[model samples]
Structure formats: structure tokens, C-alpha cells
Target: MANHHIDIHHVAKLARLKLSDSEAATYTLQLDHILDYIAALDQHDLDAAMPTAHAEAVFDVWRHDEPRPSFTNEQSLANAPKKSQGQFQMPRVVEE
Candidate 1:
């Protein structure tokens, strides 16, 4: 990867952030440093390295299914700020 500069004003606009001239200048250098680090990482050799799916090995670590005592409906709803019947009430959500 070649060294490149990020357009701080454009980035700020995309992220809906307001930055002063000094802040934009500071962030431009910081973003450039980050990109430089990524470029350096891209030059690493990994031909013989095994790909790891996760940071640590994961096996049958789940608990076996077993019945356990749980809070009753009344107990569950007792602390809710809003409740309807025996269930917690929530505000309606609108989806795009």
C-alpha cells in the first residue's frame, strides 16, 4: 500500500462530526499514521502461518441442557417501569 492522505473535512462530514481547523489538521496527521501502520502490516510474510478462526481454541464449552429455577412472570415484571398484562411494555419502533 502506498502512503496516502485522508481528506479530514470529508471524513468529518461523513461521520457527522464538527472539527475546527486545528482539529482537522491534527486528525489528518493521526489518520495518516494509522494508514502507514496498516501499510507496514501488509508487507508481513505469512506463507507458512496457519489461519486462526478465533483468538483461542473453542470446543464443546457449552453447558448441558438442564432445568433450573427461574424468576416467575410476576417477579420478572415487578421492576419494569411499564407493564401490560403480565408482559413488559415498550415504545413502538419505526423501521425504514
Candidate 2:
């Protein structure tokens, strides 16, 4: 990879960050290191490799999404502090 200089101030501005000159310099070196690592990874011979979300295959561990028994309307509202028209009553929130 070419030695591309990253504009730390520009990056910080885009990310809505307030970085000082020293901080920007530190981040620039860190970003350069990260880019170097990526460059090294690009040298790997993996033309036959298929892209995947994970390094290894992953199977779903969840159970089947089948419907189960639920509470009746009266049973659901039975413990409510206030109820009207078979529903929980909440205080008015909006003003006229």
C-alpha cells in the first residue's frame, strides 16, 4: 500500500470530535499502524476463500417460533391500578 497521509483534523471534524494537535498526532500514528496492519493482511493468498460473517460457520441456537398460551383481556387488566373499557387507564399527558 502507498504511504497515504491521513488528515486527522478532517477525520475528527467529520466524527464531531474536538481533538488537540498532540491528540491528532497520536491518532495519526495509531491510524497509520492500523493501515499498515490492513496492508499486511491484503498480502494473504485467499482467492478461493469465501466471505463469511464469522471465521467459522454459525448455526441458530433458538427454538422454533411457535405460538404459546397467553393471558385473557380480563386477566391481563385485573392487576391494573386503573382500568376503563377493559383496558389500562393512563393519565392525560397532552395539554389543549
Clashing pairs in 2: none
Q: List CA RMSD, all candidates.
A: 6.3, 10.1
Clashing pairs in 1: none
Residue-level lDDT of model 1, residues 1-96, one tens digit each, is: 328789989989999999999999888998898988778756889787999999989987987699889999999999999999899999878776
Q: Which candidate gets the maximum TM-score versus the true structure? A: 2
How big is the positional error of residue 37 in model 2, measured in Å on the Cα after superposition? 2.6
TM-score for candidate 2, residues paired by index:
0.44
Q: What is the C-alpha lDDT of each candidate?
A: 0.88, 0.85
Q: Judge candidate 2 at residue 81 and give its lDDT.
A: 96
Model 2 C-alpha lDDT per residue in residues 1-96, reported as the tens digit of each score: 336568888888899999988999888988977887677767888888887888778688787799988899999998999999999999898997
Report the number of the highest-lDDT candidate. 1
Error of 1 at 61 (Å): 17
Candidate 2: deviation at residue 1, Å? Answer: 13
